[model samples]
Target chain A: MTNEKNKKVVIVDYAMGNIFSVKLACQKVGICAIVSNDKKEISNASALILPGVGAFADAMATLEKLDLVRTIKEFIASGRPFLGICLGMQLLMSESEEFGLHKGLDIIKGRVVKFPAVNDKVPQVGWNQITKPSYSNINWEETLLKGLSEKDFMYFVHSFYVLPNNNNIVVSETNYAGLNYCSSLREKNIYACQFHPEKSGESGLLIYRNFYNLINK
Target chain B: MKNIRIIPRLDIKGPNLVKGIHLEGLRVLGSPEDFAEHYYNAGADELIYMDVVASLYGRNGLMDIIEKTAKKIFIPLTVGGGLRTLEDIKNVLRAGADKVSLNTIAIKNPNIILEASRRFGSSTIVVSIEAIKQNDGKYMAFIENARESTGVEVFSWAKKVEELGAGEILLTSVNNEGTGSGYDIELTRKVSELVSIPVIANGGAGELEDVVNVIKQGKADAVSLASMVHYDYVKKSMVNGSLLKNQAEGNIDFLKFGKISEKIETSGIEEIKFYLKDKGINCRK
Candidate 1:
């Protein structure tokens, strides 16, 4: 029964970003994920990886083409766990300027914007610290962030960041250039991160293990 | 300002650090644990450990090896070689590696980039490509010890890697490695420009000047070298010495501050003109 509960995870692939790593990540935890763009598959799967990468407008356009917006809203409404990665996390925003006007899932009210910087280094590269997590008792320390050191350094390579409308959704943060950088967030069943825990080594791997445990719950 | 990394590469077979005298080569240097501590003490930015041929042997990572490396080294470490599926990546990550890289598998199945990125996180996945310039003037991405070619163009493939959720691109130039000629400048810049993520240059590097030149002229974010650091004729300490000696005279005292201040203070960077006056190192910018 526990194995059955862990069996189904759908990697929503609308051709917007890479959904393979997420699927593989799940597979590592003994779960075989179904990569799908179909509404029925997404809604039916026990868990989902709403993975996205590339320009926000393009991601929105693809989701619209697949008629995914409604299905995602419908699926999330079902209270199943959904995980979004970098751009995956960004697409949950209400709007973005990655090309032109675009709308996101709005599950967490917010907008995604290109990183504010004085230089043309739009994409902040390499590793940095992820420090501030909004909720202290959300099992984050015991789960996703388990093996990581407090203020554990994780890998980051992005030019845009999200501003969640409801501050309560934020789980943790990092900093770059003396500016407060938001790195991770959690709102109910939806969890996200702007940094790569998978690449973060042991601390990062522990985070994945925790996520697996989360969806199983 | 993001920190410009100073890192070292350590190749571990079972327990000791191995240095290759030539390509596909091998020779035990010393305890990897010892070298890792030495590099950390020397102010290296991060560390990378390549299993070399562990996967081909049907061997899993040595837990003792990982524990030793993780316990002694305080910096980030990316482990690569023979990573075929998400499970493989996960096992490595679970053992406490900072990032997992895919090379040969990614060429055969480009989707591996996305799968790993999703399961772990985008920033946790790195696409380590072994590229060689072809007679036709196109750079080709190879896999399985360069036995197979993806038939995909390097620049196009770089874009695909990013699109698929790869956190960064680790590019090694086969033509330039061991020669100390220099990195493939045009190829490095072109790929870096095409991808949104940081591009690391590898293969050819002889001295400290080569590292600076790779970044300045090649427009790369960072460069990686092995023989350059592990050889008898050359060493990491020698390179740093040369880098320090190459600096302009007068602000000689500035060299003493690197340990306490990993980076120059923002205020000092602001009053650059005055600071330069102190060092007397002339700069147009």
Candidate 2:
């Protein structure tokens, strides 16, 4: 195993994500991470975190304008541990119907769609539970959710969720207003969650710690 | 579908954490940092820091406190009071607030809500509506710590804000605030029913049942409590002199004189969550 001091984490900044909170969370877990938009720095890091907040169309435009779309996709293709958060998670899908069909990174074969009109609010903003998907036998100990027990509550705030074409990639699912949707997925070295682990308190920190441990391994 | 959010609201005056009845008679509590950390450790779903006097000063002074709090706490933080323009909203969000609540400015220039929501995501813009029941049994929106009335009907303004792209609404009842009477279920339900976004019911929480009633009856997605939790934490731990030292900011007379208000009921975040869960209204544990 490589020395812990030698590992570096890069938080991709396309000027859209909540870079500060994610950086602070990394600092809390003893990981020296840098917030960068530089392709060279991002490609060289041991791990990458794509964090975002905003509309799908605008985010895609910003990512394309910064020329980070290719850099991010290549970084993942190189088999590095990558994590996507909130809107960052949505960008991994094929496209989003948020502001009228916008193309995504297409790393994961899926579509991002809005929550159906139900008795609940449009943006399901609150703490909700993430349970193991019935379709997969994946254990929490095997993924980025290392120490979290079943039904552990994580913070979520969004109007849309991902519908991955492959159920095997799904690690957890959450129900909101009678719609059971994929909340997080693990595809090879790629990990993404619709929830904001940086804002979920102690349980959230465990996620960063797990990612850090994975990098050191 | 989703668990109700239990938020601890801290009203700031100068540098001290203060509370007022009906949003008046400002009384000083201990350090905001101490109280905020305590709530976070005890499992507060979120936090709201309102600069109660910011409108009067014409500037929001929560940048320092927000920066300090954001570094340590890991929950969603919302800052309100005297945010006038897009620049003000950007500065506060950059200072580490997850969301900025607008009241006075949103009423004066409703377009700011649309503009800010466009610049930053809609989730970052929260419009706070301070309402008081009128003589005709209708609610009127007020601004400036509930001191000035906008003369706009509450229900209509709530709908307009949603259309303007605000992600959430923080609805406070001037009639019930700090009185420990309970939340204004009627006002909350009416506004929440009018908008599709999440509505956080603030003010008038005297007991655990009050928190329950707001979510169950008012149909509120969240509830913001100050006196109930603040008084409880102060009475149990703060009076010991271990947590609070007079920093010469705001009024510490209440702390020194051991004259913490007697009328306000007290409950911890843990206790509130337990009660809410027992009543079939789920909360983050």
The candidate maximizing TM-score is 2
Q: Candidate 1's residue-wise lDDT over A97-210, tens digit each? A: 665667777778888877765533457765667765544444456435555655665656677889887766677777664567568888777878887655454455567677
The Cα error of candidate 2 at residue B52, in Å, is 1.4
Model 2 chain A lowest lDDT segment of ten: A1-10
Please give the lDDT score at residue B274 for candidate 2. Answer: 90
Q: Count clashing residue pairs per candidate.
A: 21, 0
Question: What number of backbone clashes does candidate 2 have, counting pairs of residues 3 or more apart or in separate chains?
Answer: 0
List where candidate 1 sits over 4 angstroms from the true fold: A1-123, A127-217, B61-63, B147-150, B232-285
Chain A TM-score of each model, in the order shown?
Answer: 0.88, 0.97
Cα interface RMSD of each candidate: 8.6, 1.2
Q: After superposition, how far is residue A139 of candidate 2 from its true place, in Å?
A: 1.4
Q: List the lowest-lDDT window of 10 residues for candidate 2 chain B.
A: B238-247
- Give the per-residue lDDT of model 1 (tens digit) for B47-90: 77776666555545354566566655545667787778888886
When summed lDDT is taken over every stretch of 10 residues in candidate 1 chain B, the lowest stretch is B261-270
State residue B172's C-alpha deviation in candidate 2, in Å: 0.5
